[model samples]
Target: MKIYALLFLVLCLSQQLHAKEIDVYAFCDASTKFLKKLSVLPLEDLVAVKSAIAASSSLEELSVASGVPYIDWIEDTQKQLLVSESDAKLIVFEQVKPIEFSRYSRVINMHGVKDHRLWDKVLNDCVSVNLAALID
Candidate 1:
């Protein structure tokens, strides 16, 4: 019986570990060429990008302001609304949905990466109206 219990515990731990190793797709707007053009290291680039996002007046403003061109901001909004539905506290995919297209009026999408100083700044600045916490 003890051996069986130990085996069960091991199985459970393995499952939990696998669950935590989730795959989330992170995307930047196509307009974010400014960051892309830089040859800096990943850390430096991310910091610079974060600074820019933090300074934006709103998410819509951020999207427009980003250096990546051709990014579909309209599609991004739909993703936010969908992630907000499950009470999941985190969104892990990359695809943008279709429902939020009509409402995408150069508006803000509060969903963003976790642990980003810019994300916190946006939260404090009232740029992201929904202010959903993102995953790191």
Candidate 2:
């Protein structure tokens, strides 16, 4: 009986862990250069990239403004874009989604690439804004 109870607890804990979803933002240029570079990255490299992006002052501001935590970066691809279901919110470049990322509660579409300085304003206008609106 104790073993069965332990198993149940483990299962419940695992489910809760998986429930925590990370928001993934896919950024790309007109040629999808950034996206292409991102897609080929290994899992470790991806995590490193996430850490680096999260560490950026600009992205930190964006996270605060958008009220999103754990934002991961990925490259958008035609094949990956076909799948409609995802556990993460997607902030994609304009016209990148062919099927539409309906799974995510928030799908932010950014217009033409902007300099870091303008990113805060863009995110504030398109999404949400907070004390971190000003990016230095």
Residue by residue across 27-67, what tens digits does model 1's lDDT show?
Answer: 12221221222322354444554555555543344554344
Query: What residue pairs clash in candidate 2, if any at all?
Result: none
Instruction: Put down candidate 2 lDDT per residue, 18-100, tens digits, no spaces.
Output: 32231112111211343233344455544444444344344344354333342322222222445332312242212112111
Cα-lDDT of candidate 1: 0.30
| Number of clashes recorded per candidate | 9, 0
- Model 2 C-alpha RMSD to native: 19.2
